[model samples]
Target chain A: MEQQNELSFDTLVIGGGIAGSEAAINLANLNYKVILVEKDLSLGGKMIHLSKVFPTLDCAACITTPKVSETIRHPNITIYTYSEVKNIVKVSEKKFTATLVKKPRYVNEDLCTGCQECEDKCPVVVKDQFQYDLVGRKAVYVPFSIANPRVVNIDIENCILCGLCEKVCPVDAIDFTQEDVEIPLTVKSVIIATGFELFDPTQILRYGFGKFKNVVTAMQMERQLVPTRPYNSVLRPKDGKMPDNIAYILCTGSRDETVGNPICSQICCMYSVKQAQLLLGALPMADVSIYCMDIRAFGKGFCEFYQQAVGMGVEFHKGRVAKITEKENGNLILRYEDIEEGKIKEVEHDLVVLSIGVLPNPDAKLLFDSPVIESDEFNYVKQTDELLCPPDTNIKGVFVAGTSSGPMDIPDSILSAGAASACSANYIRN
Target chain B: METKKIKTIDIIKEKRTVSAEAKQNLKEYNKIKKLILKSLESEAKTIPQIAAETELPLDVVTFYLMTLRRYGSIETGEIDDMDEYFSYKLKK
Candidate 1:
């Protein structure tokens, strides 16, 4: 691979999600030269895709957009989207050498104006994963309308290579010949803020997430409620009808040893309630119900939020979903053992959202030498002292932040990032 | 010595060769998409109406309709009051 220009920073913050972005901004404010690397084409991370934050029901985009813009505008912070840390080597006690790979956006970043001319001419269409595949995106297009940097990336896997995009490029920024380049950096400290991935509900065969039309994941439902939603309104994926009956199956992939994740995904309960509240507002007449083994309203003001949801007439049923079968009319029949009734009861709904769990980024260890770092039983970065030094990993000068440590909501993730920044800054200063 | 830049696209393509099962699935998807287009040929139809006419699952029909809309082959017309699904017609 061709080597890009060598770069060095005081600190390297991996994963440009909210946690990483916040950490970078914090470090930058401290006058530390920082580098923020994101594997995705954009920097907002999973938080940007969410419709609203729980407890407050604040617009998620409104909260995430400013962080993204701040990270981009920070003079001391060098943001590299569509990039990853390939390898990290300890050079000295508090110094490390890292190799960063820049994945090709297939467009010249410096010259390319964020124009959709090339996208307008591209012919191939495929499922937009950014929108949870609810809508289709061009093979050559920007990630989203509000994407940070607003640069177009060619989905080379789906691109037909008709060269129409190149022909229409006014600035000739479309580069089919672009390649991944490796750039080396030396930093005094490193923060592994690589976030978590949503648990795939298809693994729980009983839920019928991939098979049934009306069955969707909570993340997919969140996408439907966003301002940039694929459909004009929150309509059922099956038949595009405004669903009168909606159901949320909490702990779909969490708290189940069968799926290998037994811990309660802390955000699932609150997020399900938040989505239920939003759904009630969007579909005032729709009957929204949540089936869960327990509602963990443990967070601050979370109980009040739960009460608010109940006040809005959202049903909270304590039960364990046994199975979900699709009816002929595309409605879903959910069979669960109602704790109150002590019997298996069936409820029919037009749409069912699976509140999937969160899992550590499986590739966390791959970014560094495994022998240098240790992962807990759940594969999250092992913190040395959860009570005192929550961000300190097994390796000195390297800290773990956000969901990289464990499942956490936005506020906790941000607080974890703050702890990581402090640890990294202290290490660098020493 | 000149170093060759590694194209990530080639790496992606090398790893993503279509499987026979995937090809079969694609064929099935194209068939369903064709059926949806044919249904829209006569008149604008809501998603549920199309699902009933085509005998395809509602979610499956909705997926095809969205794909068609993205391709600029379908456009939304009037909305049905009963179910609130828009009547989708073939874009002229």
Candidate 2:
């Protein structure tokens, strides 16, 4: 990537996800030259996908939007989306040289206006990933509503060789032939905020998500509930109508080692509570029950939020669902031993939502050397300790915050964002 | 004078992590009590002396001095202004 001799910055942040974004902002605010790199085409990270953050039923987009806007406006900060940090060389104890690959977005970034006609007209149809496949979009699309560097993309695979997009482009921005460009940079310190991904539910066949249309992941719920599109309205996928009762199964992929994640995801319980609360807040008629082994409300005001959910009439029975089978006539039969009752019980629900867990992004290991940062048994980044050094990673000058380090709610994500910023600034200062 | 021993920190995290009992009123004021008790025969030392000896949260140390005065544990009388430094003294 260094073949270009690009301008160097004081701090370089990998992963334009929440932690990295926060770190970049922190350093920039402290008057340090900062560069934030994101593999995706835009910023806001995973914090954007959540419907509402816990402790405050505040809209997720509302929290992330201002941060993205601020990052764009920071004079000391440079943002590189659709980019990857290829390599890093420790240049003495004070400087680090990095090789970065800036992937071609195919659209002339400079000329293509954010007018979004390219997104509207692009004939190639692909699953709208932001909506978690409940929706579809033309391959050339914006990542989400609150995306930074608001730009459109052209999906190379599904383009249909349609010159329609190229013909309609006012700036001749469509460049299907553009190849990957390598750039090199030198920075004083590098921070890794590569965020985690949702543990794919398909791996847990016993959950029956693939076997049934009614069963869905928590992420899918957030996407559907987001205002970007029409919410499916909590209806059963098969019948398209509200049901008498809804079941939310917490930690479907968390705190269970057989599925390969034994650590508590840390945010599932609270977000599940928020989901239940949101249901009660919006519908006021839906009966909700959450099945889980234990609730971990470790964040500020989190335990209060959990209690608030309980006060709102959520039945939080402690149990791991043993068998969930789709019953005929559009219902699910849940058979599990409720730890509180100490007896096996059966319940039927119209829709079942699995509070799925977060996993390290698949490409996380590829971009860095082994053990540069300490990871938990589940491969999530480990916080150095509970206090004093909240977002610090093992490597010097590289700090982590948000779910990139561990599972957290929105306020904690913002807190970590501020903490990461402080860490980055400290590194730059010293 | 609320100088909680090191053992109290562990007791908070391990014993009552989910309970309000974790926050307790300690036995003595942090360092002023230490200073006043140590200075039973004389007046209290300067702010710099207390700060130098106690690595405490800044606001916490201030709060204790204010509380001591409220409870008649220390009497406040300003000393000669040595340019920018202020000193406090123990009550009889």
Predicted structure with the largest lDDT when compared to the true one: 1
Q: What is the interface RMSD of each candidate, in Å?
A: 4.6, 34.0
Candidate 1 at A182: error in angstroms?
A: 0.9
User: What DockQ values do the models have?
Assistant: 0.28, 0.00
**Residues A72-126, model 1: lDDT tens digits:** 9999999899988977988788778889998888899887888989888876667
- Give lDDT tens digits, candidate 2, residues B1-92: 99943322233234223222211222233334565445433556544444455654322343444334433455545433432223555667
DockQ of prediction 1: 0.28
* Top of the candidates by TM-score: 1
Global lDDT scores for all candidate models: 0.87, 0.69
Model 2 C-alpha lDDT per residue in residues A1-430, reported as the tens digit of each score: 1246576998888877666767788788778898888898888888777777778778877877787888878999988899888667666655777778888776778887767777666534444677665534565776666677877777655444445666677777776656677887888877777877887888878779867767878887776566664232444444334554789999888888898888878788888888888877655767899999989988788889989989999998888898888876657998889898799999998778999988776555455552355676657676676488876766676677667766665566767878777766776667
Instruction: Give lDDT tens digits, candidate 1, residues B1-92.
Output: 99975444454455456455545544676688789999999999998789889999777788778877865789888877775688999999
Model 1, residue A353: distance off in Å is 0.7
Candidate 2: which stretches are off by over 4 Å?
A: A1-3, A230-232, A369-376, A382-392, B1-92
